[model samples]
Target: MIQMLVTGPKPESVAGRRSIAVLVVILTGQFMTVLDGSIVNVAIAAIRSDLDTGGAALQLIVAGYVIAYAVLLIGGARLGDRFTQRRTFIAGLAAFTLASLACGLAWNEFSLIVFRFGQGVGAAALAPQVMTLIQRTFTGAARARALSIYAAIVSGGLLAGQILGGLIVDADLGGTGWRGVFLVNVPIGIALLMLAPRVLPVTVARTDRTVDGLGLATLTSTVLLLVVPLVLGRELGFPLWSWLCLGAGALGLAVFVLVERAVTRRGRDPLFAPRVLRAPGLLATAVTLLMVMGTFGGWLFVSALHMQSDLGYSALRAGVQFLPMGVTFAAAGLCWQRIPAVAHARMIPFGLVLSAASLGWLAWLSSAGAGIGAAASTAFALFGLGNGLAFSPLMTRALAAVPVTLAADASGLLTTSVQLGTVVGIASIGSVFFELMGTTASSAADAVAVAQLICAGTALVAAASAALAVRRMH
Candidate 1:
């Protein structure tokens, strides 16, 4: 079956110079999308001060992009299926680039929020295609290597965003302040736009171009209902409307399942094929991804707060603190394929255990009154190494479980799990951190310790799920 999938002429074979260019272009797209997700964090204070933004609006500025991106992702992948990956990718990139410009030039809080949402829309359109392109273009060992690089970019982009955002905001380049963060993408986007058309492979479109209108609507609404509340619930004190949205979102999920099944029965391509969920090992992989990403997200959020708000580190200093972890993560991701294939399944569980242990170490350091010093940094690096070992392999496994024909579906589903996990983690663990951060630095340190333990627990759960996924794969 695997041979049959790769027997055809490779769409754009992952070989030599051309393959390098293709990866560069596509991965750059992925990097930009991921970068924008976290880049605004360090800039938020600058944005609020510059725009005189209110608290609710400030929250929206931060979260609006994620909500839109998560809601539209699966549909975006379906678009790639209908339109061809190359075309959809270019179009999405165009939208994202222009939105970045708009965000940079925004006149007020409202404009920035709206433009940020536009950025999300463009990201939604582009991101899944990155993985889909990799899936379609590469096979066998070559595929694994490409995925490792892809995973590295995902992890690295996140850390880079923090570091770059701080540097940009601190420099206040051309007095742009926080605006520089958005503007930095403009040139990169333009260069990619020019190169993408020439470099990207021409993928064949799906035969069934028929739109799954109901599926799209229901799925989008469900995601929006779930994501918006999670993104804003803590800020708004989890009001009645948030709970109502959660309830409605649950109902919408059930309806969405029914709608997709109906579309499948009618012999039409649904926005998301429900059968993809039933594929061996896919569900377990999704659960593992959700927990893993959630833990990472929660750590990023609380760690930043603890470092800056409590420890009196500047934004630039706080951002720099992540370097050890990011470096190790990139190194581990690039090197993991060196391990023998037979032991690959064990890597996920072992890596997750490492991550959990590292998190526990971090908790111990925090509780023991250790600041962001050498010991804590070592813990961070270890956690990153562990995550690096697991993430790429896990992604490869998830895609491998499904037919190549459903690449877009698998990509979309996996990415959505990751994004949703980030939101869920920040909301839940962030709330705990805030609750515990009472009067003094000691209290805040204690809060961070508890949060680290919670994250450690989450990582262990993810490890169990990953083990289950590996078992199911065989």
Candidate 2:
């Protein structure tokens, strides 16, 4: 099953072939990392009830992982460059597996949050290597196919988290309930860890670059300050301390940018490569990707809560409702490359617009109290198709302009933007939904309707970004 590609000068076992086995190993790491991002939401209620914790603690269980992952992504990517992609990938996967086990055994909220953060750190280490490996291992149409499949899996993982979490919680295997969600990653990770060294292609480590310690510290502070208040502020009634934290986060970001620019000017490697910033369509793609993917996180959060809390659906029923979206996403991703060049260029924008419209329709249906029936299912399917068409092409086009040398850096930046987008969407939009539900005494369905409206608006802007990117491409 393995086909030898441009095998490098490494040992025979680690070089000389690109196989499905290698692809699976890389993509599985990606799937696990992305899966952990959203799986906990489905089990949030169960986790709270079982652990006897409050809403704030539950939010931390989710947000802590994201924050850690987002802040460390660039550093993780740098590690891949400095310490060989294969080594970092294996190390990260091992750490992630151990952390997942710890999370399952956590006896209290504090322990769970700490372990979740560790899981994020592990994910950050592995994420950039997935894309880097793809860039190194494949070329031409094969590369395009690989990237498309990767995109599908990433999007699919977001939806699957709910499905998997729901199943585990409903099964209550060994009376563990929500803990099974984390535990399930253990065997899978262990299998990947064992197989990786035998199948993965090895590349030379770039030792010229070192970690940007100052840049890392400043960026971490910036992300924490911005994310922490949004997630915790409303729960604490928007205390003055939270407002101060937001202000400080803004200041930290300013400092981070200046530091990065200086680092670039001094002929030293910065956390973010200066050259990547100059690439056409890169900035636009990053913004659009963030906006588009952010909605995925926010949508799942509000929808899961509304379905379980308001519609009184069982966990299984709630998760099943998203099946339509997952199916269409895979279908559209597979077919996107078959379209004509002219039409293909329009795919991202058109998909975004279609997704926005579908989401808006779903919002209307929710407000009308149409439950998880045929109409809502159809809407989700349409939304998924559009999202599929947009994301696969968007990622391919975005990275098409990146230099091969900076592939790891670009991957890190892309993944960081994604995690940040997901966290922000969950914190801000979820906060809006929760606050509205409390103060207005609106039904959960009604709050979800309002939240979906915000998501729809973000989709519209993403469409605009896609349009701009297309123009730049031409």
TM-scores, all candidates, are 0.93, 0.95
Alpha carbon lDDT at 261, candidate 1: 85
Please give, for residues 101-199, the per-residue lDDT of candidate 1 as tens digits.
999999999899899999999999999899989988988778888999998898889899889988999998799988999999999999999999999
Cα lDDT computed for each candidate against the true fold: 0.85, 0.86
Q: Please, what are the lDDT tens digits per residue for candidate 2 over residues 351-414?
A: 9999999999999998887788899999999999999999889888888887777888888888
Q: How many backbone clashes does candidate 1 have?
A: 0
- Candidate 2 stretches with Cα past 4 Å from truth are 1-17, 439-442
- Best TM-score goes to which candidate? 2
Error of 1 at 76 (Å): 1.1
